[model samples]
Target: MKLRIISSALLMIAIVGAGCVSNKKFAQLQTTYNDLLNQNRALDSKYQIAQRDLSGATARVQSLEEQIASQRTGLAALQAALDKCLNSTSQGNTNISKLVDEINASNRYIQHLVNTKNKSDSLNMVLTNNLTRSLSREELRDVDVQVLKGVVYISLSDNMLYKSGSYEISPAAGETLGKIAKIIMDYKDYDVLIEGNTDNVPISQKNIRNNWDLSALRASSVVQALQNNYGVDPKRLTAGGRGEYNPIASNDSDAGKMKNRRTQIIITPKLDQFMELIEKAPEPTEGAAAADSTSGS
Candidate 1:
């Protein structure tokens, strides 16, 4: 019995020691696991911060690139404007000077003729002057002419040509239009433009509701009249409406608005050669743009 008790005591002690060692190893493993978890959490926080920073940087880069592109366009426009002003004539100095002298001389003669007409009679003189001539007859009863950029503009009031908000040409105005068309047909070298001007008053008609439409329709009506009567080519004509935007006189008074609101037939030299000079003056800069984009990238 005594020997059995002693063996039992020793066996219990050994078992207890083995159990303590196992508990110690389990504690050590738990502590290492906690440390690894803390390290992983810290790394994730740093990664989130880095991601935000990178996104912000990318947005800033995109904004800067957009501004650069806008600046490039502005620079190109300025360059083209400068080139136009410098080399518009495309002729030698001697030839350009000669043309300028002739134009100036013509202007003097035109002004002298214009000065002879009384202000009260100017309107009648313009209407009856028989185009290309400096003199006028009262029998035709025409309005005054204003010249600009080598084109002459004639003003006709609403009472003379149309009723309020209507595109239908009056019978008297039709006769006037026919006469104008006949003269224009005779002159082949001059390019003609018909522009419609309107007062600040709004349109109240059901057929046409807006000032823009009214202006456009009126201009088109006149153009069609000219074409039908004279067989004028469509290529030589352009119609535009300046609806209450370009009032020649004050709109505060009805009389002034009537003066301001008129269809003007502008007779000028062809702009094809001038436009060709403008179109042919510059390179597209496509390759440069591509290279710039690559560099930006």
Candidate 2:
């Protein structure tokens, strides 16, 4: 009987030990479950933040695209305006010689101002064996038609056509300018462009601060001469300033500086082959416009 009782006690001890092991496993499982729940909560929080960031990024991209579209529209309108201003007149004139002579006479005035000794064309006259027999150098300097790059260009290298610091053409220069106006009045088919350039010296005058302003004023002076004196239509003439930026010779030498410091009267035939080609150039893209918009400022 005692042995049997001892056996019963041993069985009870075994059952209690099994119960303790099972409870330990249950505690470990509970810990693992809590950890998994914490991990899931962290993942959900990160996903929410990511979603908000993505939404904000998408909205910004849309706004940028809309702005670009608006700029493209504005650029198109600007281009149209430029074209309307430039291409209004037809290209052709049956009577081109009379206009040609007036242009030559204006150049001659520039030559006379310089006192060109050699028939070397002080007026920078275009060498046309066909138009009129070559005038003597003195005569050529006194009066000659200059053809440059297939267009007539008069040089103002001899003296200051303008008073100090002002774009106003001198009264002496006006008589010659009157001749050019007569040509424009007669030749309704041709176009006129006046280009102004300046020497390399820095100008600090109160009226004209920089070379750009000086050059622009010079061009405007010529345009005014054409319009007021010659009665040429204002629409047909264009004025621009090169401001020592585009010099024909090195500015280091005195002679070169003189050449650079002058105005050019360019008379184009009505065909306008060159200007037509310029109009065909493509407009810039939105990105390019944005990059260049702040450049001058």
Candidate 3:
């Protein structure tokens, strides 16, 4: 009876130990499964965040592309308008020159936008419009007016301005000068350069010795008229005598000689921004300067 009781006790202990081992293995497996579930949830959350960012980035890129395409279309339309304005005539309407200038300025602004990332060109546009309005016309029979790069050039026939072999301006010429003076007075921010040119013929007067002297005296006479008669500020005027050096036509023909004898009044705007841009631009080489010297400014 004692032996049987000892064997039964040993069997009960083995069964209890087996039950503990199986429960320990099941607890370890449950902990591992919970860890894997947590890892999968974290991975899914990261994927959703990445997808949301990609969608936002794609929308921004598409918006930028649409804006660029719209800008290109606007630029094309502006270019066409500029071409039309330049090709049109400057008759019937007195404000045609001003219109053309405004169009040109608008085109330039658009071009600037296309070329660079910058702001407004309002001041330049206003100045150009004022100048165009003051000048008014391109052709005046004996006078020709042209504006380029914000400078105004008025070329008058010497025959219309002066008598034969005289530096005196005729009464008829005073009317034209009066108009010019009014324009100058209206746009008070310009500096005037009066350039006198002559034909190849030799000149001999009581005080004038040569073509240079004649040209100089003629230019001085005009300046005096502007100051004394029309009240143009003397400080704004500069006189230059080109003589027969810068001729527009051949000296061999009478008609050509007539065309060669002219006086040029160059009106330049006094804008600091324009001067700064010009200063920053690349200087012309010696060869280019020589070629340009052949032409009148």
Candidate 4:
């Protein structure tokens, strides 16, 4: 529209100048027209740049709106899930309570068993310590007092306890056996197991046919001594023979054979007490049973 207006103005100027206008005035009008035309071209270029900028800005705004919509949708889904979880927790509160009660009951039973085991271990340790403290250093050379797995084991070498290659109790064994028996009598609740071990050598005696006979006879002799001579309860004593099978060392060497020929007096809690404890085990609480039923359902 501006171009057409400018063209009409220039045509009017040419018509008027053809009859009366000077050459200077015509040149001035022509210069004014050229200035206006240049200005209009610059304005057109600016308009095209502004249109591109507006289109880009609109596209960016649209992208941001889409992102905001997606985020809102995600937030709604998470809120719904949280509400469902809260509802479930409220409805199943009784089941949760029952489970907690069951856990507490189990913990209590575990503690009870642990206490029983610790008490038994303490008694065994006391027995071992008392025996070790009572015997002299020379006696200890032939005796080994140890507590293994809550049992007191008094290992007496055959050299100190018996005659050479015989199950007969040595005359020198009297004092040592007396001391041991005294300790055994002090712990009335513990049962004594007299286990006899022997070396791999064969026995040639007419009465003792083999190592098994020697071992059994040796164990029986010790048990009899504890009962008859030292006043240990006969009911609390048990005799067993390992023969040459349960060797502490190799019997190929003389020293090893001597080590292998030894007797172990094992003191432990009564098996009947352990059986009683097993029978008295805690029964399942009502809460525990209810919890199991709920879980099964």
Kindly list the per-residue Cα lDDT of model 4 for residues 31-53, writing each as its tens digit. 87887787667566456435643
Angstrom error at residue 107, model 1: 21
**Across residues 1-297, which tens digit of lDDT does each residue of candidate 2 receive?**
434444555565466557776776656555555555555555554564356435544664465456445545654654454355355433212223333333344344434423322232322232433322423332223233454334565556425477655677777665555655665555466678888888888888887779999899889878877777667889889999989897967899986786677787777876666565222223344433442343224
Candidate 3, which segments miss by more than 4 Å at Cα? 1-139, 271-273, 276-297
> What TM-score does model 3 achieve against the real structure?
0.49
Worst 10 residues of 4 by lDDT: 273-282
- Residue 236 displacement in candidate 3 (angstroms): 0.4
Superposition error at 14 for model 3 (Å): 99
* lDDT per model vs. reference: 0.59, 0.58, 0.66, 0.75
Q: Mind giving the per-residue lDDT tens digits that candidate 1 earns over 31-126?
A: 555555555555554564356435544664465456445545655654454445357554332233333333344344334333322331344334
Candidate number with greatest TM-score = 4
Q: Which stretches of candidate 4 lie over 4 Å from their true place?
A: 1-93, 109-124, 148-150, 252-255, 272-283
Q: Candidate 3's residue-wise lDDT over 176-279, tens digit each?
A: 88877776686577888888999999987787889998888888888999999999999999888999999978999997898889889888877783584442
Which one wins by lDDT: 2 or 3?
A: 3
By TM-score, is 1 or 4 better?
4
Clashes of 2: 5
Q: Judged by lDDT relative to the true structure, which candidate is superior, 3 or 4?
A: 4
Mark the regions of model 1 whose C-alpha exceeds 4 Å error after superposition: 1-142, 272-297
Tell me how many residue pairs clash in candidate 1.
1
- What are the clashing pairs of model 4? none
